[model samples]
Target: RMSTISSAINLPTIYALSTPPGQRSAIALIRVTGTQSKYIYHKLTGKEKNPVPRKAMYRNLYMPGSNILLDSTIVLYFKAPHSFTGEDIIELHCHGGRAVTSAILNSIQALNDMENGIDIRYAGPGEFSRRSFQNDKFDLTELESINQLIDSETELQRRCALSSFNGENKVMFQNWRQTLIENMAPLTAIVDFGEEIEIEGMESILNNIKRDVLKLKKEVQSFIERIEKSSILQNGIRISLLGKPNAGKSSLINSLTNNDVSIVSSIPGTTRDSIDAPIDINGYKVIITDTAGLREQSDDIIENLGIERAIEKSKRSDICLFVLEADSSMKIDESLNKLLLSKELQDKKVILVVNKEDLIINKDELRTMIHNLNNEMKNQYPILPISCLNQCGISDLIDLLTKEFKELSDTSDGADPIIMSQRVKDILINDVIFGLNSFIDCLDSDIDIVLATENLNLAIEGIGKITGQVVGIEEVLDVVFANFCVGK
Candidate 1:
């Protein structure tokens, strides 16, 4: 990915390892892109074979200096404006080996200052996508979809990325954004209708404006829901565990993580703070937290602070988990239940987890008790039965978490475009709400329809940037240089 960024420089010829390094295979590709590609092919092969664009040619490679045979390769060619880089591109399918690939690259660079004056350089991270963006090969949304596909952790995420890559989301948004522009026409005309104007379709335009406004609002609602789903899938959701002291929170954490990351002694206050670790469950990142037991009695100031932090984490969490020991069998431990059932945690997404299930005499009786206890809550919570020790019901817990993420992501199949970065979100909100909405606000003014169109274009550009649609070539170059590592 980093290699793509480096190609934004003003180099004429670009080349890179089309396949990743450190691999042995039947074949590997050495790809080159530039106007001078044909010259190199001619110089080495001693044939003006031109290798018709988009055609594959079987050819023997030879080092001009020694007339020594290099290897047999299928020379693939793509003519300008039709290729991946929108330039004359050459690709060699040669044997996969470090020495062979290196030799080929060195040979390509050797004829640098020759007839074509092409400076053969390696591609930067993300430069291929960047170049494609430059040539309108793929829109900003498609670029992000590719990125997401590479980053997908879960089945659902992979599905969304594939869907977006296939342009399921981009087509939806483009159709909508374009429709919004068209719909705005009559709305502005409706607002312009006055006694002096006496427009013929005044009534019709006003009705259309109202109808379109409602439609636009519905689109916004749909977009927000989609964004919410994409966010969870891309970033992974945060689930926090909170309860009174010795609620088996640490034990559950250890079980879920399959490791003793937290202190789990019989001591009531063994874990004095929030302990968090990332674990991949069902291809989704779950940052599970084992927080200090929320309670009032604490002599140590740090422990008290930890308790406060636990409560805060619960409030900030995507899912709140309230754990209880199965042996502490009361339907409601009036003291702690009152505190938990208090206004703050109520109505939040809380899961009632019954830990220490291995110690229970009868599974049915324990389930009934936990169910009955949960029935008294202001809101219904999921009753999950698990035993951290002996690893009982851990798979069930993981299943529960996967289902939760699937619900959060609303993921179907590959290809869902997401506003994954805050930079994108900010660009969108600032342009749409402030810029486009403000344009609507100016309908009654003397501003011309052309000015409204201008605003629409601005909104489009901002949206384009969000999806990597119409990225500034210079911006791509700047970022590449800024993030450049030594020996890049």
Candidate 2:
């Protein structure tokens, strides 16, 4: 049903540059797809015969009306049902130059204006991918995976996206859907022939449905947990450095990024705002934020405002590095300790960092102080003694962070595909889970078979939304494809 609607609305030939738009590269690829794709190819190449399907041929392109030579290009043709969009397709590979690529695109537009009976237009963002979905080339999850693959920044993200694009999620969804249908079949049979079914067989079928639902519920819960954990990998892990003035917060940021991302000064409250520096940590993207130092008694309005911002950043961060001076006579600030114990930071992971370790006269005394502080707070947060000035213990800090990140991102034990989109989760929870619960309740209460089957159908439709099998909502496709590039 959706395929027919898509085909009806998308009847014209569409074209766009499939490669990044720039002049630095050696070549650029332009893709065309539609029923009239062969016509457009012939007009551009001035060849009566189309190039062999799936074969590249060298040809000279020309302007449609004046027959003016444009450029010598390599062209490939694909017949319907075999191309990316499952339509007649043509690809032109031309030299990557500001003038050459622009001239080729402009010529195609000019031909569209002069031609009759066939329409050709530039593709919109994700339009190529949308067409592929419409033609049943790939499901919605696979489409999202392709977009993720393109936008991937880290090795783990790339591998996960590639796994989804290769039909990992599709296979999982199919198995779930089949199990659901098998369970629904017995309920449907009971509804159609209520009295004709044997009592023992009915009891067996009901038991089977209950067992399958329990198993599926467990699997769905596990998938949700995996998604939550893998989210740190999908969106880079955020670590915020927070402490009182002159605690080496800025210095630590500079050391991690190896650049002057944050200004380091001995003056209190030198940093008035949060500065974010993104760095690659062992194939994972980690964003470290250097925030304004916390202070209890600040007469300066700007300093107080900076402290407020620092607290807010700490609340949102995945990990908070609470820095302290190893040589200072004062203990941790009472106000800062209270803030760390507040409800806003309940979920945040805290790590104690004692800076300027080289300045400490006694190592055993420093360790004793840290241990006592941990006991006083009633939390055994990992403490690392470091000297930012001497670059001591920086490697140890990195190793600790890497270990934490690996624990959060590990997915070796599960066979279920990762769910990347929050929209998918919303649908599963609000629609699929709700419908499943309704059906299960109906069965447990010995409700009408018709009502139970109706709820079961609703559950299946909800699951179908994930794969674009039953497209009740057009907005779902719009949202999914909106993130893709124009040529995808």
Give me the candidate number with maximum TM-score: 2
lDDT tens per residue, model 2, 1-488: 55435552347778888888865568888888887788878888888986799887998998876678888999999888798888888899988877778788888877674245667788888887777888888888898888888777666778888998999778887787778888888787787777656656777778788788778867766776778788777666888766656777777776765522222222233233335535567666676654433233222222244556656777778888877778646365556566567666778777878888888778888788777666666455788888888888888887787677776665445443264777777777777777778878987897566887888777777778888878555677888877778877
- Mark the 10 consecutive residues where model 1 has the least summed lDDT: 260-269
How well is each residue in 1-488 modelled by candidate 1, as lDDT tens digits? 22233333355677777776658778888877776778878866767656787777888888755577778889988887788767677888988988777777777777777354566667776666556656667665676567667655556567767766787667766765676667666645544663466678655664564466456646755676677677865665678776556666667766765632222222233233335434556666566554433233221222234445555666666777767677744555444454455565664466777787888888788878877877766456677787788777778777777676666666544434354444545665777544566455544465445565466556666555555544464663344333322112
Please give each candidate's TM-score. 0.71, 0.82
Once fitted onto the true fold, the runs of candidate 2 whose alpha carbons sit more than 4 angstroms away are: 1-10, 20-26, 53-58, 97-99, 113-116, 194-200, 259-274, 277-279, 289-313, 328-346, 358-377, 409-417, 471-476
Please, what is the whole-model Cα lDDT of each candidate in the order they appear?
Answer: 0.63, 0.74
Q: Best candidate per lDDT, number? A: 2
- Candidate 2's C-alpha lDDT? 0.74
lDDT (0-100) at residue 433 of candidate 2? 74
RMSD of each: 7.6, 5.5
